[model samples]
Target chain A: MPVETIDRSATDMKAEAAQVSADIDAFFDGLLTPVQDGRERLFAAMRHAALGGGKRLRPLLTVAASRLFAIDRDRALRVGGAIEAIHVYSLIHDDLPCMDDAELRRGKPTVHTVFGEADAVLAGDSLHALAFEILADPATHEDPWVRSDLVLELARAAGTSGMAGGQMMDLAAEGQALDLPAITRLQQLKTGALIEYAVEAACIMAKLPADARTPYRGYARNVGLAFQIADDLIDHNGDTAAAGKPTGRDAEAGKATFVSLLGEDRARQQAQMLIEQAIEHLADHGDEADLLRGIAQYAVARNH
Target chain B: MPVETIDRSATDMKAEAAQVSADIDAFFDGLLTPVQDGRERLFAAMRHAALGGGKRLRPLLTVAASRLFAIDRDRALRVGGAIEAIHVYSLIHDDLPCMDDAELRRGKPTVHTVFGEADAVLAGDSLHALAFEILADPATHEDPWVRSDLVLELARAAGTSGMAGGQMMDLAAEGQALDLPAITRLQQLKTGALIEYAVEAACIMAKLPADARTPYRGYARNVGLAFQIADDLIDHNGDTAAAGKPTGRDAEAGKATFVSLLGEDRARQQAQMLIEQAIEHLADHGDEADLLRGIAQYAVARNH
Candidate 1:
């Protein structure tokens, strides 16, 4: 498809999705307002970390999935924002001096560079706790089991076996050569877990049909893989302006990556295949899955 | 009180609180069992940090407060374990190279020293999330609003304005000449917030009457301050063997502390006063507050 056509398609999807996006933003901005006590500064840091920049894709997925079950927008917004909070916290901690040591993220200075490493670490920790708190809020659940399960799901995702475990794997794998399966496993756990959580959480919160959950899991798995592959491509081939980060740094760091192992063309093909698989998995859901399908396509198609 | 009498009282309280301690160990042992997926290691780290430890005071506090309003023993155990998880996480993170840089905690190599800083940091983050997850579990909550509110309170305490903020102050105030109020405020937030959460969470879970809540809060606030002061005193007067870790390190580091500011005798007086206040605040709750009062007394009396 032509670049213009794809851009227009994305715009239309986002345009129709305005209510969900707006609610996500509002929920984030509202919950993050500083209290009168010294606690305000923490919320200020949270708002600073969460409110602006980045794609907000995870939250969007949440809102979209929640809407499919005819759940109210407000409730979805809280869940969506909660996911973003986890994502943002991971990014902040990942950027710290002891971790990725990135100076910038999403075209802005990383949290540590601005707040100092200690504050950044604590801020990330606080955000992680806040996400669970948001998900477990009485307002977010009509049923105690639903609330409890959501909290547990998110905890598992963000905890060691999910995001943190994946991160630990990345730390071990960095600057080391790895075979295809190993690399795939690492990326699947690292980047794929949270993305999968976003989709799974929405389905669970909306209590979607039992049959739909398995296929949606498959759809999410593909989207998650495609998302990481695209990231690999962007790291290799995209410009700083487009990618909003320094490209080619991954190669400089001697990190084993999809493109490095598979070659650019094959990597691109595999990503597209994953996107196709994701769309096919969603075929039974029809119009309710349209935006998700479009997003899957965009995940692989975008240069950034 | 005589040292012999203090030891006898400590022995009595520990015996009375033995079930809470055993229950805490059991819950953790069950929670940390390896799952089919590879998430076992993370919980392993959590179990390592949480299962074997000092007094298990935080969990005991939760149990005592829960008993105030007749929350079932099983529910109290879960909530108590949750509080211990949060406490353990804070301790693990605080011992990291970037934070307190301690080589020992709870008579073992600190989490960062043992697990590596990356895993240590992630473990702390995971435990924070898990704490909320466990508390928010429907199995632990007979009251949905109480559960949600407990999650919110713990989040605030552990997050930026409470524990994190107090930690930031500690990091900034290391060598500074802080006054009594400044020190008190810092300790209240840093050490007191979570203890306050433990008390309030138990009471909330128990569905205590509104009037009953205030005393618990008061009780927690006083004991919280007393704990910090006692900690400072331990660092001042106790030996490594007696204390289970290095002592006098605080003064050597020139860290602003209650003992440094007020002298040993005055600091002891302050701790005693706080403990008395903590006990007095339990007046309305009758014998249900016995364990709590004993725990408060132990706070001031324990060498380690």
Candidate 2:
């Protein structure tokens, strides 16, 4: 695309992401409305954790990928909402006392800090259950096969060999020297797995051809790695206020991160390179994939 | 049925339960075998939590229910294994420091006590994910609709409105005096929900007529309540060694339970009444449901 067209699409992508964020918020609010005899405290904590705030980038990726195939935007958003719930739940549990022990997230007190540890744990567990519930619902997709496919893929992405395994690796990585290959594999499993699922879910919804899925998968892989590298950079140099959490946590913990292993300049250069390659994977889709392409740029470009 | 037939079936039921327990253990072991370069710690913790000795009553219930419609035994076992995973995950999380702070389970060291709290949490979380994955796989059911239905029901049973919500209520009830209705509702949500799903899943697998489901639902509801009441009674009067964990914990915590509210004699009577009523719900099913009837009796009759 031309320079002017690229800039316009970037603006469009931002607006589109904002719309998805609002839609998902409303969806959760309705889903979690407290009945007279409901567990109000648990619901309140879930709302507090889920609705507090984030970029909603994963949902954006789902929506963007769905748009590439002219699939229903509303369906994509609801599925995206499920993905966001899984993401938020992971964050809640990761911040617990036994884990990272983070007190603040998204510029506010973490769920365990505000809701008490038990409630926080239950809330996170409930959110994880809710994600599968949403995906399995008929409203998410008219075809049962699609819903089942989404559930299977999402479960794999979230389970032992994927994000959870990555987390275990991270805990083990503390104070241990990890090579570049190990760190890369760790990041791929920890965060990349879910991001890849976000895009994959859209393809499933669209019933895209298997051949057509390759580019999107390649795109998602590169974008995910780039996003993590950018995150490491932010932790290394970004302000705590801007990042919405304490910075330099990797250094403080002596954790083996990409920045720690490769140095800041090389890490930045690699992230930029990955983003470029991610955009290149979208070459065949023309203007229809502009939002996804824009997201690739935004992944490494964002300060936070 | 004749008295002789009933006596013979009860013996058969014990043997059946034992077989189901062994089948589920093998199923879990096969499901959790570490892949090349897999996260061994997480897998080990999951195996520890899941494989430790228990009655495996939930899987037995599922198997017994499925047998009513002459459903495939292997298929039922796989679904039962998924249910067991969910049950084990709940126990693991409930035993975490932030929750029950339990040191022992099934007469063995708890997951957190053996593998550290972080691994325990991830194992529980990953097990939750694995439950849905198992259900969604084509191996669980040939029809995607059936798989989707199973996932949907299990998620609801495990989510905020079910097990997690009940947990929240239990936490909130710590110091508060709860009446009979509140306690009943709590138990129904926490334990009854999953038991209901266990029977309901078999119905889905069998494609049972809609009206045929009512009796099983009634049977499960009564059995669930009876099971909890029995648990409360055991905590009130049984030996800690036999129970495999601390006994009289409800009294120690001053948490209101059926035993505390109804007194020991009345509580025992209540459980017996529920078990009898539970058996009556299966009156129309003949000897095919004998195992389920035996399970109801065993729920209140067991020492542990």
lDDT (10s digit) by residue, model 2, range B103-194? 98899999999999989999999999999999999999999999999999999999987899888889888899999999999999999999
Tell me, by DockQ, which candidate is best: 2
- Off-target runs (Cα >4 Å) in candidate 2 are A36-38, A209-211, B35-38, B209-211
> Clashing pairs in model 1?
none
lDDT of each: 0.78, 0.90
Instruction: Give the per-residue lDDT digits (tens) of candidate 1, residues B1-304.
Output: 3566546646667886776777788888887775533344555667778886667788788877776778777787788788888888898888877778888877877777776777777778777767876876778776667776777788788876688878877877767888888889888889899899888887677667768688789999999998989999999888887776778988888887999999999999999998888878876765566678779898888888
Which CAPRI quality tier does the interface of model 2 achieve? medium
User: Can you write out model 2's per-residue Cα lDDT over A1-304, one digit (the tens) per residue?
Assistant: 6899879888988899788889888889988887545488799888998884888899999999998889899899899999999999999999988889999898889998988998888999999999999999999998999999999999999998789989988887778888999999999899999999999999999887778788899999999999999999999999989999889998999888889889999999999999889988888888889999889988998999
Residue B39: error of model 2 in Å?
Answer: 2.0
Colliding residue pairs in candidate 2: none
Which runs in model 1 stand beyond 4 Å of their true positions?
A1-9, A16-29, A33-48, A141-144, A175-177, A209-212, B1-10, B16-23, B33-48, B142-146, B209-211
The TM-score that candidate 2 achieves is 0.98
